[model samples]
Target chain A: GQQVMQIPQYQHVQEGEDFTTYCNSSTTLSNIQWYKQRPGGHPVFLIQLVKSGEVKKQKRLTFQFGEAKKNSSLHITATQTTDVGTYFCAGKKHSGYALNFGKGTSLLVTP
Target chain B: EADIYQTPRYLVIGTGKKITLECSQTMGHDKMYWYQQDPGMELHLIHYSYGVNSTEKGDLSSESTVSRIRTEHFPLTLESARPSHTSQYLCASTRGGSGNTIYFGEGSWLTVV
Candidate 1:
């Protein structure tokens, strides 16, 4: 079975600070996806990285996939209250069928 | 927003009672998944289906069962609920592909007393 490990189980920052969450998979992944879950709400898809060493940006957010395809990261710049939520990284191994999710990183931004 | 739907956004029942959480999607996705989560915690996949009449157990062991009679509907059932069953169940669906987006329903919160 494949497992995804995430770091900094919890994060607290000021509204203007930057935040980053890293994910590492036990096995090489074919693709990796990021999701955001608001308090009391279901998770919503944020982005996906397929190519090794790929980088994608969505406004203030940037996502990167490691060159080894076994790790990924999500970074947010100048966090705002609207960006408060749990960020999860899920990976699909090259030989696996099910997507394995990391224990998400909970982010809290204070004014 | 995705066209996925879930029933009884919240529920509370006594132990030993049977319960079913309904899920449906209009996106015509071939893959559907059921995940359980505690408040502000990581998601644990309990079950998934590739399509109608096909189901598979996920990484986490669950005491529940699921049926996929139609591509648009997938329901999870618990034969006998227990207090440990209290958690939020989320239903999600995605099209066939490696990088496809997963659409999730609002989720159903269940509590067994």
Candidate 2:
């Protein structure tokens, strides 16, 4: 069985501050995807990382995949109120294609 | 956006009652999945299906049963619901090609009393 573990179960930051969350897997992953869930909404797809040591940026948000493909991280610069939500990392396994999701990091940004 | 749908967005039932959560996707995806999540908690895999006539339990052991008889439908059933079964159930599907982003339904919130 594969397990995806995320760090900083909960995080709070002031407006214009920076935030980051990390994801680690027990086994190597074929790919990793990130999702964001609002306070009372369904999870929404954010981005995906496949190549080792890969980095992708979406505006002020940056996503990085570890060199070993077993870890990933999401970093947000200058957080805003709208950035408040839980961020989850899902690792796709090579065996069955089933995704193993991390517990997620809940972010709270204050004004 | 994905065309995934779930019925009875909210449910409140007594213990020992039978309940079924319905899920359907029109994206022509071959992979479907069910996940359970508590308030402010992590998402846990409960069940999944690769295609029609294919079903498998996920990492989490659940008392619910799911069936996939058609390409667009995957329903989960609980013969005797218990108070511990109270949680939010999410249905998702993936195209398995190009972008591997998983699309999730609105989710069904169940409260067993």
Candidate 3:
């Protein structure tokens, strides 16, 4: 069984500050996906990285996959109050399609 | 937005009662999954189906059972519910590939007393 671990279980940041959450997996992954869940809401698809050392960006958010494909990171630049939510990283191993999800990092942005 | 749908967005039942959570997707996806999530916790894969009549238990050990008679529908049933069963159950569907995106439904929040 594969395990995904995320750091900084909870983070509080002031507006305009930057925040980053790291995710590491016990096994190499075929691909990794990121999701965001707002308070009292369901998780929404954010992005996915398939290639090793791949980097993707959406507005103020940046996602990177480790060169070994066993770890990843999500960085938010100039955080806003709207960014208050939990960020999750799910990794799918080469052996199976099932994703091993990391215990997400809850972000609270104060204005 | 994803076309997946989940019934009984919230439910409260007594112990030993049987409850079924219904999930459907209009995307016509062949792979569907059921996940259990606790508040501020990671999502756990409980059950999934590769296609009709191909249900499989995930890494987590769940007492609940599921049926997949239709390609677009997957339902999870708990024969006897308990207080420990209180959690949010999310239904998701994908296009049957490792690189495809999984679309999740609104989720069913079950609270067994």
Candidate 4:
């Protein structure tokens, strides 16, 4: 069975501070996806990384995939109140169709 | 707007009652999934369907059952509800390709008394 683990289950930071959440998988992944769920809302897709040692950015958010394809990270620069939500990382194993999601990191930002 | 939708956004039922959570998607996606989540907790995959008449249980074992008679509809039914069944159930669908995005419905919140 494949497992995805996320670090820093909970985080609280002041506005303008940076936040980062790491996700590790027991098995190598063919692709990894990141999602954000606002309070009382369903998860929303953010981005996906498919290549080894790949990096992608969306505004103040940066996502990275390890060269081994076993780990990924999502970093947010200058946190805002609107960024308060849970960040989840899901990984699909090589040649597998199902996606295994991490426990998710809950982020809380205070102004 | 997202094409996926779930009915009865909130539900409260007495114990031993049977209820069905309806999920529908208009994306014409072959792959559909149902996940259960607690407040601020991880999303656990309960069931999934690859296509019409093809359903599979996910990593997490659930007491609910699902039917996939149509490509656009996948509904979960609980024959007998209990207090432990209180949680949020989310329905999602994807285009079925590597790295493809998964779109989720607003979710059905159920509370069994």
Instruction: Give one clash count per candidate, in the order shown.
Output: 0, 0, 0, 0
Q: Which model, 1 or 2, shows the larger DockQ?
A: 1
Best candidate, lDDT: 4
Candidate 1 has a DockQ of 0.88
Off by over 4 Å in 1: none
**TM-score of each model, in listed order:** 0.98, 0.97, 0.98, 0.99
Q: Please give the CA lDDT of all the candidate structures.
A: 0.95, 0.94, 0.95, 0.96
Q: Which clashing pairs does model 2 show?
A: none
* Chain B alone vs. reference chain B, TM-score for every model: 0.99, 0.97, 0.98, 0.98
Over B1-113, each residue of candidate 2 has an lDDT whose tens digit, in order, gives: 87999998999999999999999999998999999999899999899998999999998899999999999999999999999999999999998764488999999999999
Which one is best on DockQ? 4
Docking level for model 4: high
lDDT of 4 by residue, A6-34 (tens): 99899999999999999999899999999
Per-residue lDDT tens digits for candidate 3, residues B10-68, read 99999999999999999989999999999888899999999999999987899999999
> Considering summed lDDT, which 10 consecutive residues are worst modelled in model 4 chain B?
B94-103
| Clash pairs, model 4 backbone | none
**Residue B86 accuracy (lDDT) in model 2:** 100
Retained true contacts (fraction), each candidate: 0.85, 0.67, 0.73, 0.85
For model 4, residues B13-105, the per-residue Cα lDDT tens digits are 999999999999999999999999999999999999999999999988999999999999999999999999999999999989787899999
Predicted candidate 3 versus true structure: per-residue lDDT over A6-96, tens digit per residue: 9989999999999999999999999999999998889999999999999999999999999999999999999999999999999999987
Q: Pairs clashing in candidate 1?
A: none
lDDT score of residue B31 within candidate 4: 95
True contact recovery of candidate 3: 0.73
